[model samples]
Target: MNIKFSPVPVEDRERGRNGNCYNPGSPLTEGMKKQFMEEIKPICIEMERKYGVPAAFLGGQAVNESGFGLTRTGYFANNFCGLKFVGAWGRKPPQIMNGQDFGVETYQLIGQPDEAWDGSVRIIENLGEDRLIFDESSRYDNRYFKFKSKPEFFDFLCRITYLNGSEGRLYPKDLRYIFDEYRQNIQRGMSIRESCSLVACQLGKSGYCHTEEGNGTPPQRRCNYYSRVITEAMDEWNTYEWTKIALTQN
Candidate 1:
């Protein structure tokens, strides 16, 4: 399913211009990467276990939303994926992005865990399978449409690449390539343990960091150290399960 298109280094910026949002560059920052390990990694593990979705999807989605764990809202909301509301199993998803007077686009911030976690499993199930068909009149493209089934979705994206005067394609092949890219990035990352340790160290220095609420803040001097420990624990927990999944090939 490997597909290639002209590299649009400016595509993300274009999405921003069109009021459609996309991740910019690497999603996580150094400090926030630490925080992600300390705080958010566990949920990703659970997502793998319960949803039967690949850890990579969760990881990528988080990377997409949190801007690689940089933005403050992304840090607090624990939303790494900018999952918009889909009602009736993909019938009509309301416009979730708002535009400013100058036409700058803004996305709605989700706060609750349920806001993201509940429906994401379904989205993940369709990941790299669903295709985006553009409609010139639809808001998201005015005529942009998501196909109901994977095969149809895939073909639709392929068909439209040369249709409607567009130069790019978004078919299954493209999806596969993107997934491969994401996996490669994950594979190149530090081992879960090391990443968590880095995060935990930062948390310990902060002294006020806790994955779940109610864990009181520690002193500033030791906060970074404690954070590292917490992150390591979380990493261990996630990695253990992720390992099981890998071994079983489930």
Candidate 2:
């Protein structure tokens, strides 16, 4: 879901013309943190074990992206990271998908042998077979990934983040670059806080908080707000006793 629709002026986007809210100010509450951590921490740890990504950072991202299952897509689509459907699934695309603004094209996933698909985004991989489908709107368009369970969603995120080659860097704005940085940080055995900070700062430079054609803060500032929020979320998620328990096992 790498679509950046700047149809209107960047001013309009910041002023809420498109109805996209970038900041919510409020951090996760204790009860909210506790409940959410209970739901996602285990999955985050699982993804960490499988991918070497920090559970805390990944969980923080889920909290930031999905708003703890509060957003429409979060609750309905179960799409935590805005993973869009860029191709079809199994067979040719259905005609209904083309009725919208424009025709929906099916494509073969990168690194997969079968190739071009319609319906939902699917690729043969070790993460898991299930993929999430997002057919409601085209904002983060592309069949988007769907999952049967929440853990699967988290796992998909980790796997996709770590995908090699050209297509693997689709999500998270700058995954290829980010993964490289994280890989370095992981090899160094940086603490969760340090790793997440590295992620935030690097992504900020990638226009995480940019506006206008190029009229926005520097990379440091652009990504600062979300980076701060994400890092804070990790702490909030950590305070939960259950989250502590799960992380201990990790």
Candidate 3:
């Protein structure tokens, strides 16, 4: 069962009529959802191979965090996991921009006049960072890491998501314990969906934002909601045609 991987279509990657990758007001279509899953499947597979994290779990998190890559942080910053840039791993803290701290330059491909002066050429530039001041979406605050590519984003996501507790705030004791529990579940031969549900519950209990509630929901409710959503997503992906084929190979 060989699954052919493909890049996201240029139109899907480009800014929509509202000047972002997909209009915020518009509902995400089935096509968009399928495209997002196709684009991320390879990256999730690679992360699973490297980190022992289940690909279904990673895919579910990406779906939950990014709204299937429709959110500003997910699409513009390539940060599918809702990771905040806290100057961890000795990285320099991002500079403030437009009254917002933790600013990172974000790049997007746009059509510009070609060198020949005849036709427009697609060039990647830091246009997204410039748009932050005017964009009213609270999620577009420029406070997340900006990656040049999806692979780079997923690699960093894996590191922080499964970090040990040597660092204080960035990799806290509870997060480390969550990672250990996930590993233990895997070692115990738990199904990916089951393991992801348990980890999602742990994340909710540890005050992680697995959904967009943003401290509005009660901890117990949030835990149940996050776990349910994650488990549902894993179940869907486990049955998806490509994912089923990919899992056969695995």
Candidate that scores best on TM-score: 3
Residue-wise C-alpha lDDT for candidate 1, range 175-236, written one tens digit per residue:
23332333343468645444334333442343323332223544553555454444444443
TM-score of each: 0.30, 0.56, 0.61
Q: List the residue pairs that clash in candidate 3.
A: none
Of candidates 3 and 1, the better by lDDT? 3
lDDT of the candidates, in the order given = 0.34, 0.51, 0.56
lDDT leaderboard ranking: 3, 2, 1
Q: Which 10-residue window of candidate 2 scores lowest in summed lDDT?
A: 107-116
Model 3 per-residue lDDT tens digits across residues 184-238: 8767877656777887887786777634565557888778888888878777766
What ranking of all candidate models by TM-score puts the best one first?
Answer: 3, 2, 1
Q: Can you give the lDDT of residue 168 in candidate 1? A: 38
CA lDDT, candidate 2, residue 129: 26
